[model samples]
Target: MNAHQSLSRRRMLGLAALGAAALAGQSTITAAPRAAAAPAAGVSDGTFVPAVVVGTGYGAAVSALRLGEAGVSTLMLEMGRLWNQPGPDGDVFCGMLQPDKRSSWFKTRTEAPLGSFLWLDVANRDIEPYAGVLDRVNFDQMSVYVGRGVGGGSLVNGGMAVTPRRSYFEEVLPQVDADEMYSTYFPRANSGLRVKNIDRGWFEQTEWYTYARVGREQAAKAGVGTTFVPNVYDWDYMRREADGTVPRSALTAEVIYGNNHGKVSLDKSYLAAALGTGNVVIETLHQVKTIRQRSDGTYLLTVEQKDDGGKLLATKEISCRHLFLGAGSLGSTELLLRARETGTLANLNSEIGGGWGPNGNVMTARANHVWNPTGARQSSIPALGIDDWDNPDHPVFAEIAPMPAGLETWVSLYLAITKNPERGTFVYDAAKDRADLRWTREQNAPAVAAAKSLFDRINKANTTMYRYDLFGKRLKAFADDFCYHPLGGCVLGRATDNYGRVTGYKNLYVTDGSLIPGSIGVNPFVTITALAERNVERIIREDVKDSHRD
Candidate 1:
């Protein structure tokens, strides 16, 4: 069968089986037993109190693992349901990989208030007067993708694992010791996420190869060399694809929405292992509304519990000696910004919400020769990257990679590193009880121009195999506004100190993408994970130990 025919047949069968399973009220796959909680280790019974880590995304999961490993008791509060759970729509809700686009899964999730690209057209039910909330910001100009589940953005990310360019890291994060940080933390982060290269065979057999080949040809024509790189996915499933045991439909490129067979999100990786430690307790469906500081320096958090209908059923108050904010750049920044503006933690410096940028995550597709059969482009991503754009003279950072195609013959994604824009502010709408994020177009103009220029160069150089018509038109019309990577509102220097500590609030820290000052020019996950690793280690070795040692 042709590729399209095979894909269609598999999709039909899978959907039919899913329907049957639902009707029978049974799952084809059985879930493992929940892990039991273990006793706290390191601290005295009375002295070692359980801390609550709010938000179950990247930062939260990483913090939970680190704290749990240190024997510190922690309760992880996730506003979203587990990605592994069945949603109200009777479909599995894996953030970026959700098979059904119309699923009402976000309605029941606490983090649903945080918007996403998949539901951009659907109103946010959690926000009252939904029209105002939806219309308040620039959705057309920028595509914002956020995760509202147990794994958060990890559930929706492309699963490409990339370390930031060395110069970008050294220049942006001077406070971080690059050599030690990379050596100690990068490996640990990659291992935890099970990062590895996509199998060469899978690339050769998959349609994704066609897409990547086109991307490479286009890059080469522009005098830019493209290379394959590793991704964070289960190799076993990939092998199954090679054998055709699992149909190619199983490896379909429907990633950013959620991947069914590919991608190792936090729920399956770090969070799962942390649960195994039995020292981590996760509370799903708990949305943190406010965080207050008590007289004794402890944190008093008010959280609301929401049901599947997206209605608040109960409000609960919890106290913890320490609080870790891992709500991504947008989520964390909004929370901290609201607290500061409302005088809850007004002593924060001028830096709060001072540095914000989208990591220049512009998404554009390049067309390649139709005859070049980029095999199985769905299962594997463009593994190699071109670093020629790193030159200061060029003033741009761009990585050319293969994109999974549907109807298109072959296409690749070029993520460019443009100049960082001025920090944007996250204003809290008291009426809506949520954040209203706004950014000016002028802030990213230079980066946008630089990105277009880079693509134009690539297109001109590859007249034989590739073309850059879309990028050229986008540059001339200035209409390309959506970025896969959205970063920085409560940036590292402003919202927190050099060490990721909130300036005015004691025992409170901000990690994750929020700590990234501006754009890193490549996929930001590895950098975020590595930084979190470094910060958490420091917190354990310095702050936590010093408190006990003294």
Candidate 2:
């Protein structure tokens, strides 16, 4: 079977696991045994939980849900605030077209990782201090864009829920059980994330996807095949959006900030279900600073609560029998590196901050001819990708991204995922209290070359050239300074055991994108979720349950 067919079959079988009750938006999941009183608010409360999961991203959400389901009371600590409340402007997130301070964290001026039109510092705007949905973490050469609020990257990403090619999976994670991953955890993650493909019939007819169709046609003309990318957005709602029967999100230029509708983010899926268990508590804006093991084998965490202005409110000491780090790639890596540097976790594996990669992300735009007419009515959720990963020399899977500039710009944008083998390392800087990535822009050359090889073919076939206007100034076309998908840092089998159990420390786990060693050739969240699903099950069965029995 082709990739599309295989994906369909997997989706069908996974949906079968969502029994009638869950399909009807009802829960049959029973609450697990409570470990202690729900997580306390103050330091003096002497609070403790059975397990503490850091961050509110995919891995954290999955671990929290699974641990709660297994009767292991869990507490999740997030550095960013919960983004469920609408501001005075009547929206929880700011749109990408008009980004304000709500687009960034603790900054009076907004810093969008993507530079403005003509690279003229015009995209960002100033606003009052508030906890935004997106954060642009700047390093020496790379700027990583990550979501900061309750849903994490789901709050800002394109909602593309893609599984990496199985063959590539084996090559990247050689020790992982490929059969079990494809047959079990991958489908489970897709089903839980509410992933769905766009209706092909609607895609063919909708004006919103004309840009994508043009992209496919151009790619086909260049002998490059295109595939429909699956996403976590609700397809039925998107269909209604096209028919003018519902309020639009994907059609209304709603990505890279947060989708107000049609997107089934983690907040609506796993995290919501976890809360229903009553054994999971999430403390937003509580950032874990230091971690040290107590004499009794429990872990002690020093957490600082911060307000919207990034001001510290209180520092609390909390203890947990088990600690799971799910604070994405950068956050988790920094926490561990800091602990190691300060001698808190002295014997942490030497590979703690190694094997980091940006998933070979490169963004560029093609200036289509006026006759091509890339549409003004464009969907924000990309539904197509030019699949060129089979190319042995320059493998590239380029997503047909939306310009969504609210007008016909005749620009075909692409975010190409390439296979670059370069890896970087992170080091803790004592002076700044930050973790610095040693990756240089020069290391991104391979990724750019891979992307250019494919796009150059399309450009040649179509008699079009790169859109120098979309990216920053100068003749350079590819945007290589930033990455939306930051993978690795604390890699599997290196920093941790195969099951994500950190070596030298019992009950310490790493369950985020940090576990991915370098590139995965596709979006990392699904893989992170599946891996967490696999590891947490074993941990509960072999570790948690055994300890309780003992």
Candidate 3:
């Protein structure tokens, strides 16, 4: 009963938005109200539960909350710590400029996407292996970025709560009802996630957003239409940070690893709301290894409890009546692929590891003119994007990312989501006990080309060129290798039914980004949350009518 346990008990599992708003000078934003967890009937070690959710991400949070509201007892398993306890720096998370062991997931060094600046290895740092927040899972040709904590990807993403265009959403996921999504679920998801826009008047005058202003002006030079993107970071709190009234997290560069304050991550939003339901509980540092069916239509999961140093503590057997996999595209897909290949869940269809894509992700930077100094002081929170998705030839929504290197680097960074038709596949490797991505470098050619088509025009019109030296000495302008938005591995219609029910398994569900087919032409979390909201609502109403009979 120390500080960490006390915090969890009082705040509802990592203190959700209530504590976050309080830390941000009592900001108006807050998550679901805190309700004491209902006393468990008997859920404990080697015990049974009415429902079990794997991963505490957007989907898992939604599922747990909805199920709890429907009077179901649910348990959530996460591979990382609660992240509520502060470290020696008096912060729960370390900053990007001076990252520590908390920046990486059991890696000896921090792997920043911008590996270097001016051909110098200044971004990444050597660190000790720990069960930290951000994790980079390297496959043969692609490196997938994932968040390793209770809040999942919400802890590490850019906080861009973007809802995809209705046309694009219909094109990617035709099975989903577009009318319900755009009209109902999208707004509901935005409200739950607390998405907000920065004031345009503040944007014009603040030095913090000068980087985005320059990006917008540069895109305008190429006749490209730039739009302001909404984010989960508190705009009012950010204004205070810029004014030096509040603690600096986004302004002083606190992203990629984790944000200390102002960011309304899932631990404070959906997950917090889920915890407030009193029927849900989360167990951290527990990784599910295998999934097998019990004799009486129950699911048996072989889970490992580990310490932050990667020490195996115990292996436990837990059974659940219903199982929801919300461990993102990579984690959720691998579990099913392994179960299928190893003959555990033999009925799983061939689509378990198919229709996987990188969402046409490509990262590139432009060498801005010396006259247009893109501000020495910048906020890590992105607020603008060059929207060229209407172009029929190569649709792209490029987020004008900030190069928060704590100095005026004279660079305009972007992470472009292109409409490339290319997709990848995942193959389970029996020897390594892992699912290996079959995506090769050649597969990324179309993605790079689509991004180049848009950026080339900007370069030509602005009389600038690509920053070849940023990505190391190879002179690769576009970073087509690694991707942040990893969608589709267990695709929606192909891998499961229209409502995300597993094709051959009755009580199995896929509720994360694995449902989308490769590309969505925007930041994916909002779409993921909305789709989860839609799916879980139907599930609680139709599937679990008698779930509480016990």
Candidate 4:
């Protein structure tokens, strides 16, 4: 192999070894330990704990950490793998251009958001079914893209950590106190997540972010202003990547699958701290199938322990005095809906499956003029956004996304978060024993129109046109079918109480994207983390510490 390739190989091997050792040596809480499916015959599984958190995403991690810090013994259940060890290629994750079985969740082929390029299906690849990092849960009209590992969505997202405008936040959740969220919880979430911003001086000169600059310039041509967005990816490490000072992850198109370096996922931040508190334990490859309340006021969960190949190893039952459903929008909503439908948790409110939306997500690409060539070297981490949210007509915050094909495709892609009032809901499908989203393509009309409104202005000024070949053979430009930010389903004020307490149950709580109603006007991770911080702080103060029931 070449010298650079050989060096990268050795570096990845060393990292994998260190990660394995760290996981193995977390008894005193050195690093976050991810226990494999089921232990040996004599070992006692974590079948019961003082508290159980049912996810490892932004909100779940926050809840776990706070509970652990509050001295509550907590067990976190994650369905996906830990994703710390290197694979056959000596890397934790595969890049976008070349994906493997590790790119998707139990699917025979990868389901990349960008399904096609130049009308060719060059984005996806067929592989064996395995528990991969990213999962595109397809419904009738909407497909929700979620991460599926120890750190959950943090493992697969673009790492854009954005807080919504206060006015819009009030509009979405008026019940939430804005002063506290802005002053205390938001900063706390930012600190815990290690959110950082790219240096504008470096951003201006770096070849890696040329696409963002191009996007900004094009948007400015139409009088639409752009704003810098914060992210969890280490900006300094990204600059070093551009300078060839370290092995590349973002520069090599490693997003949507996972990032090996630079990015600070929840496992590296909150989950690690939760483990360090010596009160949190994370069990991977354990999926919660159903949840019910016991007669004595405790909650019981029917968990399925499985291997990476979808082989069911054991059907186990776990119980907790306090239960937190921090699973992503789909997983948590489905579990509660199933429980309610099966008469297990009969007191679960009707709002458990209502108020679902895709954060008004719409993706479109522009064929830039040959002269305005976006650079071939692009960072997968998005750093810029078109800040038109204040526009009273059709508010939108369109992020300048990277088309990191490792070559110039002459395409400026955008994933716009529009303020569409349309929302979807989930219904219990008894035959399949799952919650199905009752959303139609017609509901996305407002999002498409809002996106077209902004892009049309840009296209008019730049004399550019939309790329019709990117989404499919329908000659459509706006991709409204899939969304990266899947919000709602167990909405805060509607499905759960103001503090994430379930409306009908005592010790059950909802703490994820499911708490948000529809749109967040930007990326939802920071808001999710902050809201979780707000909710769990109150929860721990009132419920866990004092044994107060909601």
Candidate maximizing TM-score: 3
The CA lDDT of each predicted structure is: 0.60, 0.83, 0.85, 0.86
The ten-residue window of minimal lDDT in model 1 covers 128-137
The reply for model 3, stretches above 4 Å from the true place, is: 1-44
lDDT of prediction 4: 0.86
How do all models score by TM-score?
0.79, 0.92, 0.94, 0.93
Return whichever of 2 and 3 wins on lDDT: 3
TM-score, structure 1 vs. true? 0.79
Please give the distance, in angstroms, between residue 358's alpha carbon in candidate 2 and its true position after superposition. Answer: 0.3
Ranking by lDDT: 4, 3, 2, 1
Using TM-score as the measure, name the better of candidate 1 and candidate 2.
2
Q: How well is each residue in 323-442 modelled by candidate 1, as lDDT tens digits? A: 898877777777787787787877877676666677765544454455654444344334556655554544555555444434444445555556655445566677876666567667
Better by lDDT, candidate 4 or 2: 4
Off by over 4 Å in 4: 1-46, 546-550
| Every model: Cα RMSD to truth | 9.1, 5.7, 5.1, 6.1
Stretches of candidate 1 exceeding 4 Å from the true structure:
1-49, 86-143, 201-206, 247-250, 369-377, 380-382, 395-405, 409-413, 464-479, 546-550
lDDT of the structure predicted as candidate 2? 0.83
* Tens-digit per-residue lDDT, 180-284, candidate 4: 999999998998888898899999988888899999999999999999999999999988888889999999999899998899998777877776555567777
Per-residue C-alpha lDDT of model 3 across residues 168-187, encoded as one tens digit per residue: 99988888889999889999
